[model samples]
Target: MEQHHPSLRSEALALLRSGVTNREVAEKLGVPRGTVGWWLHEDRKARGVVVAERPHNCPRCLSLPINRPAYAYLLGLYLGDGHIVAKGKQNHLSIYCCDGWPGLIDDAEDTMRKVLTGTNTGRRAKIGCTEVKSYSKHWTCLFPQHGPGMKHQRRIELSDWQQEIADGFPWELVRGLIHSDGCRFTNWTTRMVGGKRKRYEYPRYYFTNKSDDIRKIFTDTLDRLGVEWRTLARGSDPYNISIARRPSVALMDAHIGPKY
Candidate 1:
């Protein structure tokens, strides 16, 4: 936004030449993207440097995962509880997971790193959650399922690539979605049999989302993994979709335990 030092200006151009996107260069240099763009063009022109038409980063460099476990996990997080904020010409993705389980946060962060490859990742603390965030216009490219308004208010479908990832690593995807917007906890019930009170406890999982499409993705992944889950309410509103079945609980526990 303000004047930059001569060295910093040259550094910005160098970053561009090295395959960094203009938006990223500006952010890294702590300046506006327009400034970086104009300065780079002027300097290149003055030096008789023939610049490529596209100021955007290289296609190969921007190529993130299309069908990988990390990408699938990130997708599930985005579908379940992530939001993208478009700030001017840049887009930032933020996914918040409850602090009750730090493993969820770790998984989300690891997924981001594995997918984004070389981008800067950011995090923040919320009242009851931890946030994993990153800024990149390419995020939109990675997640084509994004749309205007809330997920429940809009319909978004998975692309063919996403379907492939879902089919291949359904567990990671299912775990991410459930971790962000669902819960794995103990369920206890008491009954009077033959005038005696008895109590039984079992582990159950619940995945909740307002979007039918998102809910379907979660359940579909479970189905692929042979994990049983049920829609708690047929036509009425229950809290979330439930997976209280014993076999399902054991299967999930083997993979996704309480994220402590």
Candidate 2:
């Protein structure tokens, strides 16, 4: 950085405080653009004005084009297992992935970056899982479901734009939801077939969520995709949505297999 006269900085600050753009001030004063920006920043700091970082390029707010499929998938993951923390100096969207599935962790981070282009993302290791986090103040703007309580305890509903994306990319949403809160496993039973004992294996998919609204969202999407799902009661609460029909299971297998 080149040193400049104190009087030049004073003149730059005067221009900046008077609504002159940094570039314009730099151009009029023959100062470098970077120096003008730095001076303006310093002036604001000295005057007790908090200099916020450049605003994130929010697709919804800016009417900017976004990767809809990626957004759809990330939304599902968020509804199923991710959350946003917006507080003093602590704002981010975090999706937790089981450590056993390193690939899913990577995919979660990648999908977040894709949706929030050029955003900063990092990971934190937790017991039995890793939290893939994207730092942004606009996460709540993107995911309106973020609120003051647990998702299951709150009413979760997507906005019109989100519903449109989910409709367009139903499979991706299903994949993300399954990767977060659903699982595929094989159930075996022995049966007598023509006087011979035979073992039969049935592969099924299950999505478990305590939130009625989230469950409805999942089931409604399944209905739109022509895939059948049934509710299975666990103890007193029916938190499991099971896809056991051969055709439905096959559809799920074709679209969203076991997590990698």
Candidate 3:
């Protein structure tokens, strides 16, 4: 067996005692599975937690009570461009994002793994789209918005736990939505100032989604953060939201700058 750090052993044991399985504890703590198994076996000998006594299902796969920034971000991504499908005892969660964006795929994978403690991988699905997929037994519980049809056709609402997370860290939710389906860039204009023409460029954030409910969730979170936004054509079309002012832009910069 490879020599391992004592901290890794401690982390693995902690996670295992907190209900994570040996496999999940190893991957989560960046330790070898065999090491985790040995550690847990030793712990079981000490505390009497045995394989036969273990739940047939993995506790980490069950309903997660984490309401941190990562969970809020994943919730936003799901609302924007993710899909959760029930597949045999697990819910497969996949979020499609722009492949050209900087560090988006990497960030999504990291955030999901941190929040759900699950194995995740990203793949190129199309010309400009990448999908980050992970399996968890509690995805449906986390994102109750998942349904038979499209998000717009169905009501997109947050669960009570999701509401708690969004209310606390609305910025993370905004970041995930913007990273997945929105963009921020400089908008320049030229006008007469002091009887002379001057050019100025300002940063603005734009979020466009086909689902009104999703857009409302984004805007509502922004509202909670006191971020200003304008709706161009309400109920007319998607991509109708824009935040083009200074203070709002500055706030967003502090919270949800370019993911990289």
lDDT per residue (tens digit) for residues 1-260 in model 1: 57779999889888887989989998887889899888877978988998554343322345633438777788888988898887655677899988877777887877776776655678899999888897677677778777678888887798886788788888888877877788788899999988999997888998888788788888877888898877887577653789888888999989877666
Instruction: Report the lDDT tens digits of candidate 2 across residue range 155-199.
Output: 899899899999999999999999999999998899999999999
Pairs clashing in candidate 3?
none
* Candidate 3 per-residue C-alpha lDDT over 114-191 given as tens digits, one digit per residue, 9 for 90 to 100: 776645455657777778887765667667787898887988888776788798888788888988778888999999
* TM-score sort, best first: 2, 1, 3
Off by over 4 Å in 2: 1-47
Lowest summed lDDT across 10 adjacent residues in model 1 is found at: 52-61
Order of all candidates by lDDT, from best down to worst? 2, 1, 3
- Note the residue pairs that clash in candidate 2: none
Query: Please, what is the TM-score per model?
Result: 0.75, 0.80, 0.71
Candidate models: Cα lDDT each: 0.79, 0.92, 0.79
Q: Which residue runs does candidate 1 get wrong by more than 4 Å? A: 1-67
